[model samples]
Each structure stands twice: as C-alpha cells, then as structure tokens.
Target: MRELVFALDYDPGWNTLADTLADFPDARVRSLSLHATADSLWRVDHATGSPDALSAIEDAFLTADYYADCLATEPCGADSETEVLDETDDTLVLYTYWQRTPVCTSIPHLALEHLGDGLLFETQHEQRRHTWRIIHPEDADIHGFFDALHAELSADVNVEIIRLTGLSATNTATFSAEEGTLTREQREALTAAVHHGFYNTPREIDLGELAEELGLPRSTLTYRVRRAEAEIIKQYMNHDPVSPSDPTS
Candidate 1:
C-alpha cells in the first residue's frame, strides 16, 4: 500500500503542478482544496489521492497548538478569514502557541519525535517548509511525479505534505473465490456487483448501476456475464462447448 503526497506552495499553481507530474499516465488527480488564511497568500487545503474522493481539505493538526482549537468553526471551514489566530513562535507549532498541552509535547502512548520527523526533514544546513498534500492511487503509475516534485521544490521549500489519514500503512486484499471458481476479474466484479445490490432479492439493481460500481461500461459487463452464464449452463448439462468467441470451430 504505497502512497504519494504533494504539499506544494499556494501560489505555485496547478499548471506548475501538472507540469510536475506530466509523465505519469495513471495519475488520477481530480480536484484541489483551497485554504485561505489572513497572513499567508494561500495554502493547499488538500488534494485528490483516491478513487472515492474528489477533493476535500479540512482541519488537520500537526501539533498541540491546533489540537484543541476548533477546526471547521467557520462556514467556509478552515479557510475562513475570521478563524485567524496569533503566531507565537518564529513558526507556529503545537505547544509553542497552545501553552503546555500534553498532546503536543508529551504523550506517553506515542513518541513526539515520530510526529516531528514528518513535520521537518532536516540536515545540518537545510530544511523545507511542509504542508498537507495528496496523490491519487492511480497516480502511482507515474513514478516520476514524486521524484519531479522533490526536484522542483528542493531548492525553495523546507517541507511538503502527503495525506495518510485515510490510507492504510498496509492493505490486505482477500478474495473469497477458490482458484477454480472464478478469475480475479470475476471475483472483483462480483464484489463490485454486490456494491450494486445485485445479489439482493428484489432484483432492483440496474445493469448500469452495477457497471458503474464495477468501473466498467455496462456493455462490457454484459458480455462477460453472458459468456460466464453460457459456461455455467454447459457445465450443468455435463457437456463441454467451445467458447462463442473461440475460433477453433
């Protein structure tokens, strides 16, 4: 379950963003979430990195300063002008602005150093500003995207953000079908068909609905299911038949 993240500057813009990942054929970025603050020009509220999501940037806490502070308090959410607050440190982090809250500085259940690692990657002489970023799973086919982003911003920014709040550190895919029962595609299609309520009693599901759920055109699904049905019927009749499309006839 590898993932990609992009935490670019607010003004760098999406053309620059697209230019950065232009080579990746499978890149699936669909939207961007914009967050506006009083002082800074703008920040990447969030970005798309999933098949199920378009784009959404909400309140994310990197330190204790924002831990207890209410996010989404404004109508426009974390992007609102009225939600601005004081920056007490050279830069604002959790305890630096929120006082001695244990959540930021000292939580026995977790090591604060782990959080700090992602916040700022440092060398003796260099650091980069970081922010929340996301990459679509479809974007993984574009291996160059991440490398290009790192190269493009390495000279100017101290840090960049990638979203993991919804991603699994590891994914376990379990298929219920036996090896002879179905092909991987059928197993996947069946699971997706279940998403359409195809197995439900009323037969209320539309073929288009099942196709959409399975991420295929209804015509393709119809062809596959018909072929499969023909096979099932032949097997039930204790006879074998060449596939309709097979040319060995």
Candidate 2:
C-alpha cells in the first residue's frame, strides 16, 4: 500500500485537561508550564489557575524556536516516570518541563499562556480542515503553541492519515488502519472472495460457488462477500494520499 505523511497542525489532546484541573477546586492549580522530556510526560509546574495568571497566554507568532531534546526510542505509557524536568523561557512564555509519554509524537508543540497558575493550550490536528484544539490545563496560557501549529498545517496542506486513538465512554473513532478493525470471520470471507477471483475484472465467480466452498448459505455468502468488497473499496478510496480533483461544471 502507498503511504502518505501529513501533520496535525491542531490537535485536541487537552479537552479533558481543564476538567481534570477543576477536580481540585480549593487549591488552584499553579506554576503550570509544558516541557518535553527524553522519556515522555510534560512537566506542568505551578499547575494552578488564578486571575492574573490567565491573562498571560497570548504571545508570539510567525517565529517559534523549536527546542531540541534527547529523543526516546521506546514508546511511553501511563506508568512512565517523569521527574522535575528543566525550566526555560522564550520571551513571554515560561517552560516548566517534565516527562510524560506524549499521546502521539507527531503532535509538535502546544499554545501556552499563564492563567494565574492554570494554563490554556491549543494544538493543531489534521483531518480535512486542520482540526484545531484549545485546552486549559491546570495552569498556563498556551495560545502560541496552537497558533504556530495551525500556521504550519495551513502553510502547505495535504491529505494526511488520522490515526484513531484514545477512546472514552462518549468518544467514537477507533480505526488505526481501515482494516485494523476487521474481525477474523470477516478476514476469512474477504480472503476467500479475493482468492476465488470473485472480484476479478468481469462477471467473476458466482455466489453459489462461493457459498458451497465457503460453507455459507448463498444469501449469507453474498452478504459477506459484498461487505468485504465494500470494505476494501471504502478503505482504498478513503486512504489514497494524493487524489485527483473533482470535475464540476
């Protein structure tokens, strides 16, 4: 299969970040900042939300210095260890670093701003229109991260694969590859159809033959084979990276 690479200029990983912080009402999350680590997990310092803090989130655009750090070769997990990482500042935004396995490495930086101690963030994700996300974690103003990412995605947009990850009770999308979700039975039926030349250029094989050999009732066999063909076609049509423009009068 052909491969295509696209970026998530705006990603919404922090949707629950703010809600997560609200859990602690009394002790406002403070000293919040984002830092990349050699391992994973971003160190959020002074994770709190105060009035004066929330005002500092919007800053920087057009130019952002990409910070380089040691890259981790292994995948990160919820149990991944994070220590009091480094600290730095880029003009307006301050960095309170820590290591937490990033959900996806492809996601670049976050828009940050100070909100007392709480932080507001934004990320760029790609689908059709670049999906932009805004987040207010415990404490910080992350407006810039989102801006740069959005800009990058729009700078020169192209078709990109959207990996379905992180599922919750209400969340839906879960396909990694279109075929990733196929069941064993589905795979078997599809394989049989393909092998029997059912999908061969022309009239191909008859349903009765497939049903007899595959040990399925004719109706059942027809449904399964049709379904399998549809899935393959759907995936092919959906996964194509470069596509021809639609002709319209």
Q: TM-score: which candidate is best?
A: 2
Q: State which candidate has the highest lDDT.
A: 2
Clashes of each: 12, 55
Candidate 2 worst ten-residue window by lDDT:
59-68
How far residue 226's Cα lies from its native spot in candidate 1, in Å, is 1.8
Candidate 2 RMSD to the real structure: 19.4
Residues 1-249 of candidate 2: C-alpha lDDT, one tens digit per residue? 111122221122222222232332332223343333334434343322333322222111111121111112233332322233332232122343334445423232333222122223333211212222223332232233323333333222221222222223333322323646566776887688779865543324555677798789876765564455445434543442322462310
Model 1 collision count = 12
Query: How well does candidate 2 score on lDDT at residue 88?
Result: 29
Q: Give the per-residue lDDT of model 1 (tens digit) for 95-130.
A: 112222222221111111222112211111001112
**Local distance difference test, each candidate:** 0.30, 0.35
